[model samples]
Every structure is written in structure tokens, then in C-alpha cells.
Target chain A: MNELFQKVLAENSILLFCYLIGSITFILGLKMLSHPASARKGNLVAAAGMLIAILATIFLYRTENMSHLGNYAWIFGGLLVGGVIGTLAAKKVQMTAMPEMVSLFNGTGGACAMLISMVEFNKIMEHHPEEMHRGHLLIIVLGAVIGTVSFAGSMIAWGKLAGKIKDKTIPGAQIINFLLFAGIIGLSIALVAGFATTLPVFYAILTLAAIYGILFVMPIGGADMPVVISLLNSFTGVAAAFGGFLYDNPVMLTGGILVGSAGTILTILMCNAMNRSLKNVLLGSFGGAKPGAAGAAKEGGGTYKEISMNDTATLMAYASKVLIIPGYGLAVAQAQHTCHELEKVLEEKGVEVAYGIHPVAGRMPGHMNVLLAEADVLYEKLLEMEDANDQMSSTNVVLILGANDVVNPAAKDDPSSPIYGMPILEVEKAEHVIVNKRSMKPGYAGIENELFFRPKTSMLFGDAKKVLQELVTELKQM
Target chain B: MFQEFAAFFITNYRLITIVILSIFLGIEVISRVPSVLHTPLMSGANAIHGVVIIGAIIVMGSAEPNDFVALILGFLAVVLGTLNVVGGFVVTDRMLEMFGKKKPKK
Candidate 1:
């Protein structure tokens, strides 16, 4: 019986069957992930499929010599250590820190792809120097370059998001990036075509790719991070796909391709949400400089009005309908919970309160929704941009909470504005617009919001959390 | 170059077919997803690429006992890949947990 089991494990066909099953589960899991109802279970299903694939590979793999795989200790030990660290980090991370954490995790995946390419390349050089095929070599070089870039780029993005690294655009930065990219491609071709088959040349390609990755992300401003992260996510996927090509592994190919396409589609979706093309995002260092200085100076419509906290609380308390627009500032101030408290208080006063979520609000795609969800805001009450805009005119009070660019009328009225033509929440359509901000500073786009100067708008200046807390208290008294 | 690619494709037609089909399937499945689920779904897709851990294991298990470079790289690759898989899914699940049972008791 033991011999029969070993025989079954020795067959490559059974492993292929397992891989096919894993691939199918990944597709099904991703299919279920499109909706909120089954998203958690969908993640589990994909994870279970990954586990099956891992176990099957451990027991069933055999080489050309029909030698079964060895070194059980290293394999299981590595997995155990990684699994524990990953779980703890994921569990410990706060929702506000999620974007940075995701970048860190994605970077690790990129590193893994690069390392796998290196290991496989080393294997070829050591054991089968004469068996080099251009196709195989190309996969190796492509995987190494792309994986390294993804890893390095993600680390920079993670640093930027975590506030550890400031955006730096060196002089002639664009020229330097272009040349490095050219050099990487040139070196990659040399290695792939056997012009330089030495490991040193291969390593040079990776080094150049890594530098290119760092430079690629270094100049991008905060507003473009969602697009940058999404693009890197796709690069990592493509790198993993090359790994699958190297091994002829269906599960890897399917998962990699799925991620690749998903990331690509998402990158496009985010760019559309910002009313910018992918090319425009890459070339334009948006939110990096105060280019908005000119735009703001030109749009100096008038001085803005300020409302007292007591009056602000009374205004919302008396309003029949209130629409709250939350933004990246809200996330930075950790005011989602307090904002939700205000929402609930207003609701109890027989006032209608619903959140208007801009697709590109906060620091990431869907960032505002996640923060609100963490505060136990009902999903139904969170309206997308279009939905919120449709209801804007009927809204008695539009409360802009630590949000700016998404609500700026400049996006609609000023064609010369940097964010012009970008879809914004039509808070100006509401009967009254009350904005909660820390100060008169411009938003991430560095442009002064024209809405602030509108006659219907009143700025309530304070920290979002403190102000919301005070408003909640004031409402309770009424 | 064309001949090389032709030979490669002939040998890898099945895998190539799988790759092509999966790309379309991926785009189709999530084409209409609400923007609210973007972050979780992106993180979920990120975790799925951790399947490269299988390749890492293969390199580790198949290397000669004396090949320190291969073994070390493979070990690190496995560890990082595992982290991508485990952390990605776990974090994605946590995010989705909040989205569960939308009828908030509060």
C-alpha cells in the first residue's frame, strides 16, 4: 500500500491534476470576490487551493532522473516562519496603515519572484550549462528584472505612504529614468540572446531594474500613489507569470495571469476615477508641487466664511437631510468613528444622513469606504459618487469632513484648473455646504477649493475628530 | 526569433492557452465590481500570486546538498512567498469581515 502511494506521487500526471484543481479554485474564488457577500469565503477558497497545491508539490514532484524532492526541513521551516510573521503583521495593522501594509506585502511577493528567478538561474548554471534555451533564458531575465523592479518600487511606495520618505524628483530625473530603463532592456536582451550568459551580466540587469524601480516611484506625488501601486501590482503578477512559464505550472500561471489582469483593469479604473489617463499620471507629478499656487491665486473669488461649532451642530441638527463627504484628511485624523457618531446622532434627530464616497477619496482606491466601514457605517448608507451627486440638490446640508479636492467646484467650472474635468462630489448643489478642515491649506492636489469661497459654504476650522466629537456632544444636548 | 518563439509555443501551448484564458476570465469576473471592494479585491489578487511559493519549493527541494546559493535563495523565496500568500489572504479576509452582514446592528 505504501509502495502504491509512492508510485502515485511519483507520477507527474497527478501533480498536474492537482495544479488544475488549484487553478479552478482560484478562478472561482476570484469570481466570488467581486461582491461583498462572499468576499471573505472567496479568499479562504483561494487560500485552500494554494495549500493543496503546496502539499501536492511537496509530495509528488520528481526530477528528470526521477529523484523525489528532498530537504523537508528547509521547506516546512521556511513556510512556518513566514506564515507566523505574515499573520501577526496583518492582524496587528490598523486600517489607517493598511495601504502601507499592502505595499509591504506586495513587495515581499515581488522579492519572492525575483529570488525564485535567481535560484532557478543558479540551478541551470550549476547542473546543466549546456541546456540553455533562449526561451528559458528569456523567462529568467524577464522575471528577474520585473520582480526586482516591483519589489523596489513597492518598498518606495510603502515608505512614501507611511510618511517615512518624501517625494524627491532629482534634476533630469525623467532622463535618468529613461536611460536606466533602456539599459535594463539592453542588458536583458544580451543575457537572453546569449551575448552575455555569465551570471554577473544577469545580476547587472537586476541591479539596474531595481534602481529603475526606485527612481520610477521616487518622483510620484501622493495623489498618484494608487495608480503607481496598482501598476506595480500588475508588474509583480507578470513577473510571477514568467515564473510559471519557467516551471510549466498551471496554478501559478492562472493565479499570476488573474492578478495581472485584475491589477491592469484596476489601474485603468483608478485613472478613470481621477479623470486622468495612465500616461498622464506617470508623466505628471501631480500633488507634488504647489502648481496650484497659480490656480488658487487666480480663483481668489472672495474671503471664506467661518461658522461656530454650536451653530454648525445646530445647522445639521435642524436640517432634514445631511450628506457627509469624507476624504483623505478624515483618514489622516482618524475621525471616521467620531464622524459616524455624528451621523447616528443626526439620524436619531429624524435627519437623514448618508455618506458620499468619492471613488478616489483618501489615499487609495475605495479608501474612504474601508475607513467608514471600520467605523461600523452601514454599507447601504455609503453612496458612490454618482449616487451622491444625484441626491445633492435635495440634501439640506452638505457636510464636507476633512475632504477637499473631491468636492471642489473648480473640477467642474474652471477648465484651466489642474483638476478641471475631474469628477467631483456636487456638494455645491446642496442648499448649504459646511466644511470641516484643519485650516485654509489646500488639498492633496495643492489647489484651493473654489467651493470654500462660495456664498453657500462655511468653513468650520478644527481637527476633524475633535470637531466631530464636540458636534456630537452639542447635538446630544439638543 | 520568430522560429524560437514558435518552438517555445509549440512546447508550451497548453500553458500559454491557460495564461491567455485566465487573463480574460479575470477581467470579466470583476469588470463590474463596486469601487468599495477595490482595495480588498486588489489585496486578494496580490495574495494569489504567492503561488510562486511552489516554484521556490521546487528549487529548494531539487538543489544539490552542496549548492548553498541555490538553497539560501530558495529558502528566502519560500519564506517571502509564503508571507505574501498568508498575510495577503488574512488581511483581505479581515477587510472583508467588516463588509459582512451589512445590516449594522448600530
Candidate 2:
């Protein structure tokens, strides 16, 4: 008995030490993540913490029954298969597809949390069906509901962002979604109240929550995808936290809480950047089919003046200061490298060149920075929207490359516009504004840009990459 | 019933404290990040949640062989959790790799 007691005591102490180390490393890693230079090392540090936690659970914490080779095979097999597939996918996916991949991984976390809850519920039902505690049942229900919703919702977000799913809403879909959400809550309460069979009720809640998840995201437009993705990510984190609560594992609990809070903070920041509330994003159903041609056809209000490549080259080549504003169009064209080249050429000509990056310029937060950084653009050349706006007035010329909505004057001048009050690049403040695009079509927000029709703004119509290349060639001749 | 409630709180107060402390720390840390690293940070946090795989392994190990449903669920959880952890870290690392310093020779 004494030996058994000592063994138990030693194991508990070891588990405590591991949890402490894991928590500290996670904290340190996240602290390092605040800066770009140390972010990679931060990730590795957090990964090391995870490894320690996993090792402790496997060797020190497992029960005697789990010592069987069959259990080991399943556990290691999962790690090997998942590790290989995840590594390959991460390696193969392009930077442009990063947001979708993040959503996919977030869904996997949600799935694991949901499965844990389900397995735990089954275990309890089989062993202690007669003495179920309400608190335990509540945690299980919350984990299942939130996790299933996050998993399903993230998949839809991934599909929508990846162009696999169309952003179409069935009539009265919002009402139906509300009803499904209410139904899930009601069923969860009933399960806790012991009014029905535990297993079926649990599954019913899962199914309803899954449906609610799909319906919740189906109506949201592409413009709101980043917010939705962040929100769903937080949901998954919260669900995982509930799983942690169910198991009383300190490391799991800390990790889940950390992710949950961080995701929530990001969601809030993205919402503020768009000047929209979370409720509006969820219910406003902002984005849909590209704004029809009728909006642009009503162009009698103003006409856009087109500038040829030679003229554009002359203007940029002689300019004292030039600001380049890049948007999703640049990303779609994969022209960041060429854009960087243009910056270099202009810099060599004694012109001060800098980038104006709107906070929400690309599909995801900081997306423009990633694209430009990939092309080895100097970090100092990239300016935040506020700083760029501060210098826009004295700027001799502003080159808007495949960027529209962020530069749209409607954000400030037109109160009737949907994107009104949203922060923009204010590129029109420059003396000369040149916009590079394929045509006069509206941007992703499906709104015609008032800046396009301004006298100071000249449309340089073409693919951003080809236009930049042609302009570079023209500048060389000049 | 009151004594049972107190006992529950006594057993779980430490966990509740950890959860609250971690949440505050998370928010504080995340708020300091520049917008440029938001995507990578989000992906990194996603991977951290894969720590749930430990829960899965523990549950599966303790599960009886006859408990087929629990076994299957636990196994799938392990797979999904591993994927989240591995994919999240690798993808975040790839993204951070692109944010290199300016080349000296060039």
C-alpha cells in the first residue's frame, strides 16, 4: 500500500511539473509573437510546450489498461497520419490560400473538441447513467454544441473563401437559423433536466447545431468573411476550453482559454476596422453577387479619364514622391514582386516611394503585408493607412494598383454608401491619382468608386502585373 | 447539497483561476501584435488548441475494448487534433519565413 501511494504521489508531482512548464512556455511564446523577428521562435517554443504535455499524458498519466499495444498503435498511428498530411498540406498551400487553410485547421480543432465531448458523454452514460451531475452534463452539452457549430461553420467559411461554395441565401434563412439555434438550446436544457434519453438528445443537439452553423455562414458575403472566420475560430477555442473543463486538465484549460481570448480580440479588432458591429456582420448579409452593370452604367454623374502607359511612366518617373496602394487585386494577379520591382526602379530615379496599406486591404488582416514581405519589400517602405494618409496631400502622385474599395472616397464623402464611415486609404488626397485595373468595374464591395471619376484620378486600365511591367519598361526608355 | 457545491468549488477553484488568468494573458499578448502578423498569430493559436489531443489519448487509453463508439471517437479526435496542431504550426512557420530581412548582397 505504501509503495502504491508513493508511485501515485510521484506521478501526480511529475504531471504538475509538466503542466507548469507547458503553461509558462505558452505564455512566453505568445509574448514573443507580438514582434515579427521573434514570432517564429515563439511558435517553436509553444510547440515544445505542447510536446512536453503530450509526452507526460502518454507515459505518466495513462491508466494500466491503456498500457496495451493496441492503444499505442492507435495513438501513434493518428499522430503519424495526421502529422504527414498536415505537413504536406501546409507545405503545398500557397500564401494566397493561407486564410482558407487556417479555417480548415480551426475546423479540425473544433472536430476534436466535439468528439471528446461525445466520447466522454458515452462513457458516462455507460458507467454512471443513474447519477449524472448537472454540471458535468452542462459542460458536455456546451462542448458538443459549440464544437459542432464551429466545425461546420468553419468548413462553410473555407468553402466560401475558396470559391467552392456560392454566397447565396435561401429566403427566410435567417429566421430558420434563429429557430435552429433556439431548438439546440432547448434540447440541451432538456438533456440536463433528465427529460429524455441522453444519447439521442445529445446527437440531436449536435445535428441541430451543425445545421445552425451552416445556415449562419451561408448568408454572410465575402466582404464579411474575415470577421466570420475569426468569430468561428473563437467559437472553436471556447468549445475546446469546455473540453478542458470536462477533463480538469490544467494545460488543456490554459491553452483553450488562451486561444479563445485571442480569437475574440482579433474578431473585435477586425469588426472595428470595418466600422461594423458583430451583430451587423452576422445579420446584415452584406456581400452578394457583384454589383450589376447598371450601377456603373449610370456614369453620367462623372466620367473617368484614362491615361496611357507612356504618359503614366512620365508622370511617375518625374514625380518627387509617389505612394503605391496595393489591394486584393494585386494579390489575385500575383503581382507583388513586379510591384516591388516598380518601387525599386522609381527609387533609383531619386523618387521617394512608399506603400499605403489599409488595415483591411486584403481578404485577411495583414494580408497585404504578407504578400509584399514575400517579395522582399523593405519593412520601412510599408506605411499604415493613417501614416500614409498623413502624407497623401504633399504626395506628387499616388499609384492605386488593383485597389478600389479601400481607396473609395465613398467611405468619407457619401453617407448613402454601404461602406460609408469605413476607414479608407484616402489616396485621392494626392495631386495625381492613377488607378490600375482591368476595367471600370466596381471593387469587391460592389460599389462604384467616386475616386475613379475624380478629375485628379486617371484610370490606367490593365492587369496590375502587366501594367507594372509595361510601366517599368516605359520608365527605362524615359 | 450546499456541502457538495462547496466541495466542487474547492476541487475546481484552481482550474477556474488558471482559466481566468490565461484569458487575460491571451488578450494582453494578442493586443500587442502588429496587424502584419495577425494571420500567423491566429494560426498559431489554433495549433495550441490541438493540445486537446492529450485529452483524447487519455480517454482512449482508459476506454474499454468493448467500448467501440468511444474508441472510434477518441481515435478520430486524436487524428483531428494532431492535424490542427501540425498544420497550424507548419503553416504559421511558412508565413513567418516570408517576412525575411532585406538581403545584403542584392
Candidate 3:
């Protein structure tokens, strides 16, 4: 029996079993993740599969000569250090910073894939140059290129999201990006054709890819980050899938493909929600072009009315149904809790309150939902954009909380507007509209919200948290 | 030429089939996920790709003691891959936990 067990381990049968289990668990976990109730458990189930795969690899994985992989200290030490740092960062990150945090984590994944390609390339060159097949070279080159780009792009995205890096666009920037991408591809083809197999040539390809990645993301404005981040995420997944191909490992293959396709779908979904093509997002640099001169010119003569807090409170207090639309500003001011408090206060007054969440309301996709969830807002009260629009006609009051472009009439009515054709909240459909903002400044998209100048709309000027607090106080007294 | 291609396909049919099927399965499973769960779902998928840690471990284990570059690269890959795996899942769980916390009250 012991001999049979040894044989199984030596022949890699046990490792294969572990891989199969890991793959199955990954599929099941992802399927479970579709619904809210099982999403948490789904994550745990996937984590368990990863644990099994890792332990089995450490214990049972064998080299070509059937020797067990040595170097336990380095392996365990790396795992321990990384595990501790990762857990700490995840635990400490605030909800508002979640987009950057996801970018940072995804960047590390891309870096890991890049490093693996580098290590494997070195190993193949030094040990088995004769066995370097065309397929092997293709996988390595593709992995390195994609991995480096994803890594660099994600880091730039993280920086931009955290405000550490400013949006920078050079003269003829699109042409420059095109040239760099071409150079990387040109170098890769050279390597694959066996014309330039030297490390310097390969490294040159990587360097160009890194540059392209940086420049690719540097000029994208804040409003377009959801698409950029999602695209980078899929790039990382595809890079990892190349690693899976290199190793012919089932678990890695399935996981990588799963992420790649899912990320692709997510990117498309984000683009669809904004009603912009991915090409338009990349080329137009929709949000970063100096706030569109036309925006100022368009709203130049329009006047917006302001509402006092006393009247605002009274209006909401007596309203039959009030729909509250929250945006990045609400998260910036950390007013989700106060907003929820205001909701409760309004509810106590026998007023019906529901949150209208645009798909791209905050910095990232589904960002507003996470913020509201953190504030203990009941999930059912949060209505998506379409549902909110469906109820807009009957809503007695449409309260815009630190939100701007999402409710803009320009998206629908202004044909030449940069944000034209983008689906908005259609707050005009409601009987009354009140916008809360710091000032007349444009939103992240840098567009003047024409909705504010409409007859039924009135601006409530103040910080979202302060205004909400004052309104709560005013409502309680009423 | 056709015979050669067939031979190649016969050898790699399983992997090819897995790759193709997984793509369709991926699109099918999350086709109807509500927009609210998008963040957690994306984060969850990010964590899944951290399975690349297996590849990292394989390289690290198999490299010779004298191969410092390979060892170092392997070590870094392991660290980053672990970070991706651990961090991705933890952050996602944190987000999903918020979603789960208030459900019992409903």
C-alpha cells in the first residue's frame, strides 16, 4: 500500500487529482458567486481549492527526474510574508479606496505572471536551447508582453485613482502609443522567427510593452477609469492563461480563462452602461481633455436656482416618494452613513425613500452599491438605473446627492455633447428635482449638468455630509 | 499536412476542449449578475487567477540551488502570486461580507 501510494505521487497521479479538484471547485465557486447570498461562501470555496492545490504542489510535485521540489524555506518564507502583507492591506483598506486596492492587487498578479515568464525564458535558454519549439517561444513572448503591460498599466491606474499621478497627455500621444505598440510586436515577431533570440532583444520587447502600458493609462481621465481597470484586469487574466499553457496545468488554465472571459464581459458591460464604445473610450480620452471648452460655453448663460435647507427639508418630509441618487461625491465625503441616517429619518416621517444607483455612479463599476452596503442600507431599497427611471414619473422628489453627470440632461438632449447618448437618470421625469453639490463646478467628466438649470430643478449648495446632517436635524424637528 | 494537424489535435484535444468550454461557461454563469454585485464578482475573478501561484511554486521548487536568478525570480513570483491570491480573496470577501451582513435582517 505504501509502495502504491509512493508510485501515485511519483507518477503525478495525485497532483493531477488535486488539479482536477481545484478546477472543479473554481467553477462551482464562480457559479455560486452570481447571487448575493452565496457570493461570500463562493469566495471561501474557491480559497479552499487554492489551498488544496498549493499544499499538493508543495508535497507531491515532481521534477523531470521525479525528485521532489526542494527549497522549502524560500517557498514557505515567501508565502508567509506575502500572505501577511496581503491580509493586512485588505483588512485596512477603506471602502472608498477599494478601486485602487483592486488595481494594486491585480497589478501584483500581473507582475507574478511577468516574473514567471522571465524565469522560464532564462531556464529554457540556459538548459534546453535545443528544445525551444516555436510554440514555446510564442507562449513566452506573448506572456511577457501581456504581463508587463498589465502590470505597468495597473500600477498607473492605481496611482491615478489614489491621486499620486496626474493625468498627462503628450502631443501626438495616440501616434506615440501606436509606435510603441508596433515596436513591441515587431520585436516579438523577430524573436518568434528565430531572428533575434537574445535576451537583450526579448528584454527590449518587455521594456517597450511597459512604456506602452504607462502611456496607455496616463492620459485617461477619472471618469473612464472603470473601463481601463476592467480592460487591464482581463489582460492580466490572459497573461496568466499563457502561463497555464506553458505549464499545461489544468487548474491554472481554467482559472485564467475564467478570469479573462469574465473580465472581458465586465469591461463590455461597463462600456454598454455608459453607452460608449471601447474604441471611443481609448481614442477620445473622454474625460481628460481639459474639461471640454464647449461645456463652459454651453452653460455660460444658464442660471440655476438654489434651494434653502428649510424648504429642502420640508419638501422631502412631505413627499410621497423620494428617490436619492448618490455618486462619487457621496463616497468622497464619507456621507454614506449620514445618507442612510437621512433615509431612516425620512422613513420615520412616513416618507418613502429609495436609492437610485447608476451603474457608473461612483469611481468603479458597482462602486455605489458597495458604499451603500457598508452603510447598512437594505439591499432592496437600492434600485438600479433602469428601475429608478421606471419609477421616476411617480417620484415626488428626485434628490441628487453629490452626483452630477449621471443625471445630466445633456447626455440625452445635447447631440454634440461628449457624453451624448450616455444613459442618464432622467430626473426631469420626476415632479421635482433637487441637486446637492459643493458649487457650480462640473463633475468628474467635466461636463456642466444641464439638468441643474431646468425649471423643476434646484441646487442645494454644501458638503454632502454637512447638508445631510443638517437636513436630518431639520427633519427630526419637523 | 492534414494528417499532421490531426495528430497534433489528438494529443492536445483535452486541453483545447477545456479552454473552449471554460470560456463559454464563464460567459454563461455571470450573464445575469445584477450590477450591484459587479465589484465583488470582478474581485472574485481576480482572486481566481491567483492560481498562477501553482506555476510559481513549480518553478521555484525545480530550479537548481546555484541558479540565483531563477531562484530570485521564482521567489518574487511566489510572493506576488500569493499577494494576488490572498489579497484578492480577502478584499472581495470584505466587500461581500458587507453585502451579506444586512441580509439576515431582511
TM-score of chain A of each: 0.95, 0.94, 0.95
lDDT of each: 0.87, 0.84, 0.87
CAPRI tier of model 2: medium
Model 2: CA > 4 A from native:
A63-70, A288-300, A476-478, B1-10, B100-106
Best-fitting candidate, scored by TM-score: 1
Cα DockQ of the candidate 1 complex: 0.75
- TM-score of each prediction: 0.95, 0.93, 0.94
DockQ of 3: 0.66
User: How would you encode candidate 1's per-residue C-alpha lDDT over B17-51 as one tens digit per residue?
Assistant: 88888889888987887788889888988898888
Lowest summed lDDT across 10 adjacent residues in model 2 chain A is found at A62-71
Candidate 1 Cα outliers beyond 4 Å, as residue runs: A1-11, A292-301, B1-5, B103-106
State the lDDT at A13 in candidate 2.
85
> How far out, in Å, is residue A178 in model 2?
1.0
Clashing residue pairs for model 3: none
Interface RMSD score of candidate 3: 1.7
Ranking according to TM-score, highest score first? 1, 3, 2
| DockQ per candidate, 2 decimals | 0.75, 0.62, 0.66
- For candidate 2, the per-residue lDDT at A141 reads 91
> For model 1, what is the error of residue A197's alpha carbon versus the real structure, in angstroms, after optimal superposition?
1.2
> What local lDDT score does residue A91 receive in model 3, on the 0 to 100 scale?
98
| Order of candidate numbers by DockQ, starting with the best | 1, 3, 2
